[model samples]
Target: MKAAMIFDMDGTLFQTDRILEASLHDTFQLLRDEEKWEGDTPLETYRDIMGVPLTDVWKTLLPLHPTHVHERVNDVFQDKLIQNILGGMGALYPHTEDLLSYLAERGFPIFVASNGYPRYLETIVEYYALDRWIISSYSIEDIDSVDKGELIRKVKADHHLSHGIVIGDRRSDFKGAEANEFLSIGCAFDFSQENELREADVVVDDLIEIRDYLEKVK
Candidate 1:
C-alpha cells in the first residue's frame, strides 16, 4: 500500500516553546501598557493551550477580557512572533532535519498538516527550507472542513495514497488521525501533557524514532 506521513509544525517539527512564551509575554505586557489588558496573563496557562485554534485560544485564556481586546492582543502576539522569527528564535527539534532527509532519500512522501496559522506554517517551512523534503504544507486555511483529518483526506486524494499518518504533539492531532482512521504518532518531547499524548497509536520522544518505527512498519 502507498503511504505518506503528515506532520504538525509547532511542537512536532519545530521547538517553538521559548519563542512562543517570550512573544506571548511581550504581547500581554505591551497591551497592558496600552491599557487594553484587564490583568496579568499566566504564562504557562497560555503555553498549555498552545495547540488550540487561535480564536479559541484567546477566548479560553482571557475569557474575562473583551473579545476585541483578545483580537488586538493576538495581533500583537503574532507580530512579535514574526519579529522573533526574524531574530532567529525557533529551530527544528533534534534529528528533525536528518529524519526528513532520510525520508526524502528513500522517496517517501511527507507533508505538513498543522493547525498553526497559515502564515506561521508558511514562514517556518520557508525559513527552514523544509520544502526540499516536504511534498506540500497545509493548514486550517487550505481545507474546507477545518479539521486536520479532512486536510489529510484531501492530501491523500491529491497523491493517490492508500494510507497516511499524523505526527504531532497534541490531543487534537491524535483525534484527527483517529477520525480519519490513520496512525497517530504522538511526539512526547515537546509541550503536550501525558494524558493527551496517550491518545496516539504510538508515542515517541524523538523524531528519529518516528523514522525507525515507519521503517519497521514498511
Candidate 2:
C-alpha cells in the first residue's frame, strides 16, 4: 500500500492560537457570569498545554477545581470553541490545503490524528472543506487514546494503513512516530519550542518544505 500521511491538527495543520484564545475568553466570561469561575485565567496557559489530553488540560487550567467543575468548564469550553470555529475564528497554516491536495491527488492516504476532541476535529474538517482530501480523521476522545502514539496506531489499524509519516510540532509527535515505527516530520513553523523537533526524522521550517522530504520517500 502507499504510505499514508498522518497530521496533527492543532499546531500542525491548523493555527489554533486565535480560535482557542477567543473561545477560552468566551468560556471564562460565561462561567464567571454563571458564578462558576472566579479568577483570571490567561489564554497563554491553555496555549502551552494545547497538544496534551483534555484531562491534562483541565488539570492544569483548573488545578484547584474539583472534577465536576472540570467537566462543567470543559463543556462550556467545547461549546464556545465550536461556535468560534463555525464563526471562522481560525485558519489553517499557509499552503495547508494546497499540500493536502497535492498529496491526495497523487494517491496518498491522508488522515488527521489529533489529541483534540472529536467534535473539534470534525468541525474543522467540515468547515474548512478538508474532507475533500482527508480519507479519515480520528481524535483521542473518539478512540479513548492514551496519547498521540495510540491515536496513530488506531488510525493505522482501523484503516489498514501499513506505512506513513507522522507530522506535528511537538515531542509527542516524534515520540509517537518512533513508537509506531513511522517516519516523523516535525513542523517548526508553529508552536514548537527550540530543540523540540530535534528528534524528528525530518524537521521542516515551513509547511511547503514537507513536499521536498516527501519526494525522497515517494
Residue-wise C-alpha lDDT for candidate 1, range 1-218, written one tens digit per residue = 44578898888999888588788889888877887676766778867876777777888877888888888887888788877876899888999999999988887789988777777888888888999999888887677665667777777778787777889998888988887778899999668889998889999989999878977977
Candidate 1 lands at a TM-score of 0.92
* Residue 92 lDDT in candidate 1: 87
Q: After superposition, how far is residue 95 of candidate 1 from its true place, in Å?
A: 0.5
Q: Please list the residue runs of candidate 1 whose C-alpha ends up more than 4 Å from where it truly belongs after superposition.
A: 144-146
Q: Any idea what lDDT model 1 has? A: 0.83
Each model's C-alpha lDDT?
0.83, 0.85
Q: What TM-score quantifies how close candidate 2 is to the native fold?
A: 0.94
Worst 10 residues of 2 by lDDT: 41-50
